[model samples]
Target: MRIAVTGGAGFIGSNFVAFFCKNHPTDEIVNIDKMTYAANPMTLEFLEIYENHKFFKIDICNFDEMENILNGCDVVVHFAAETHVDRSLQNAEDFLTTDVLGTFRILEIVKKSKSLKKYIHISTDEVYGSIEAGSFTENSPLNPTNPYAASKAAADLLVLSYLKCYRIPAIIVRFTNNFGPFQHPEKFIPLAITNAMENKKIPLYGDGTQVRDWLFVQDTCRAIEVIIDRGKTGEIYNVSAHQERQNKQVLFKILSLLGKDENLIVQVPDRVAHDRRYSLSCEKIQELGFEPVFNFEKGIEVTVKWYERNQQWWKTVKDKDEFKKYYKNRYPGL
Candidate 1:
């Protein structure tokens, strides 16, 4: 299989790429990334040693460039987006431009290509807003609360439209909160872990009771592989680890693993239009043989050890002016 992955330098994208390269050496994987502030090319540095892997530093909105690059690919996994909810609350135009317009362009190219097999759109459960009780099925109506979730919801609808109108071989995969190694420090888990590592206080929003089902990046990659091979066209699948944790609970786990003091957690203002909880039904994907293999306790332990060992990977990044500005701007009262 020839796979083209957008946002391949980002957290989950890199994880998928790495797993594909190691497990399926015979298949070719080409990655396209805009190399945004949240993305570090170094995360995908291992691609340098893999002959089957090729990477291009290009934005998804560049349709002409992406059209040529994605030609003849069997699958196109779209992951490129401005994904930070806090950052989106500050400036949402980039989110619309990158998430909406980018998807439109990618869809146009995929629709016109004869050799393309399936388009896997990576979406989020935030599209369903807060589900206080029952798990949201794939048919649940979208009710996005924040700009970031709204943008993703829009893109998800666009992908479905193409599948419906043009009969494109496309599937949307909505994943719950994902955390693992190589995640950008701007994300919640990485931010908490890294801050705790430096003996600095980790920021917790409001009462830190926002509930999100956590999915390990590796498990997500595995499900994507299953979808790539067995997923039905014009369908949507929910992938999760069934490990739901409150934001504060996740922080406590990280602190416990690192032997850090409980006082390191500082409560801050919550997100504007914050969703109280997001739970998804993963039955559809399970029918396709997708079950999360990693337990959150064990996965998080491995993730903490990774940050502890990978000082060079993120220390310089955290010290940069960009990182400082982002931290000051995003975390209130820091």
Candidate 2:
């Protein structure tokens, strides 16, 4: 099978690319990444020697370019998006352009491709907004709060529209918070781990009481693999580990694992419109024979070790001028 993975250089995307390339040696894999600040090429550098793996630096928003590359692909795994919530608040336009427009462009191309079998759109649980009572199922009404979530929600609706209007064989997978290696340091898990390792103050937004369901990146990728192979077309699946924890509790766990102190955490003003809690009901994906292999504790240990051993990987990114500017502007005292 020939599959095209968009945003293959980013965290989850890169992990999926590496996993797919290794497991499907006979399959042709095309990785198209825009190389955004969050996308690091080094994540997929190990795949350089693979004859069946090819990398293309193309934005999904570019129709002709995306169409040319997506022509004969058997499947399109859409993982490209501007996913940072804080960054989205700072600049919502980029999110709209990349997430909504990008997905639309990919849908248009996939609609026209005769060889395409399925299009899996990777989405986030945030599109369901803050769920206080219970986990959000695939049938939950979309109530996106932040600009990032709004953009993804728009894209998700667009994909479903194509499925209904054009009969495109598309499936949407909405996953909870993902934590693992290769994630940009700006994210919660990596940020907390790196900060605690460096003995720097880990900034906590608000009282850090916000709760989120965590899914290990590998488990998420495995779930996606199952969905791609067995999921019903035009269906939406919620992939989650059902592991829920408050932001402060997660910070303490990271600190304890790193032999650091909880006092290292500093409360910061919360981002505007921050969701208080989020959880996802994975019954849909579970019914399809998908189960999470990585438990929360095991996943945390593995993730911490990855950051500890791969200091050089994040060091370069942390030292970049752009990253510095973002840190200076966002956290101020960091």
Candidate 3:
């Protein structure tokens, strides 16, 4: 099978490329990526020797570019987006353009590709907004609180609309917060790990009581692979490991694992309109015979070790002038 994966240079996207290439040696993969600031071409350096893998540095918002790449692909796994919530708060325009409009452009091309068997859109459970008491099911109403979630919610609706109005074979999967190797340090898990490794203060937003459901990247990718092969068209699947923990708890876990002092944590003002909690029900995806293999403890260990071994990779980006400038401008006073 020939599969096209957009945003294949970014964290999860790059992992997906590696996963697909390793697992299905005979399958051909066309990686379409925009190579944004968060995207690192070096992530896929190991896949360079794989004959079945191909990379195209192209933006999904450009219809002609997307069309040219999607010409003969059997499936399009759309993972391209500006996905950082904190960054989105600082600059929402990029999120809207890349998440919403970019998705529309991809869907438009899918509409024209009659041979396309599936279009799997990688989404987040943040679209369900904060869930304090219980998890959000697939049929739950969307109440996105931030611009990032709102943009993702909008793009998700567009994917469903195409399924209903145009009979496009599209499926959406909303996953929990993902962690593992190769994640940009801007994200919580990597940020905390990297900061702790460097003996720097790990900034905790607000009292650090906010809750998030965490899932390992490889398990999340496996679930996506299962859905692509077995999920029904026009269906929405919630992919999670049911591993919910408060932000403070996650921080403590990372600190304890690293044998670091808790005093290094610094409480900072929370992001604008930060959701207090997020959780999603994975019953639908579970019914499809998908199961998360990594528990929270094991996942964290693996993730922490990965960051330790790959110091050069994250270190290079962590101290770059552009990365530091963006962080300073975005999180002023931090």
lDDT of all predictions, in order shown?
Answer: 0.91, 0.91, 0.90
Show where candidate 3 strays beyond 4 Å.
none
For residues 17-125, write the lDDT of model 1, one tens digit per residue. 8898888999999999999998875786756777889989999999899999998899999999999998899889999999999999999998899989999999999
Which lDDT tens digits does candidate 2 get at residues 241-314? Answer: 98999999999899999999889999999989889999888887888899999999999999999999999889
Note the residue pairs that clash in candidate 3: none
**Candidate 1 — which residues are off by over 4 angstroms?**
none
TM-score of each: 0.98, 0.98, 0.98
What is the Cα root-mean-square deviation between model 3 and the actual structure?
1.1
Per-candidate RMSD, Å: 0.9, 1.0, 1.1
lDDT per residue as tens, model 3, 1-334: 9999998888888888889888889999999988888976568685697788999989899999889889989998999999988888777999999999999999999998977999999999999999879888999999999899999999999998898899999999999899998999988889999999989888899988888888999998899899889999899999989898999999999999999999989998888788998888788888999999999999999999999998888988887888999878866676
Number of clashing pairs per prediction, in order = 0, 0, 0
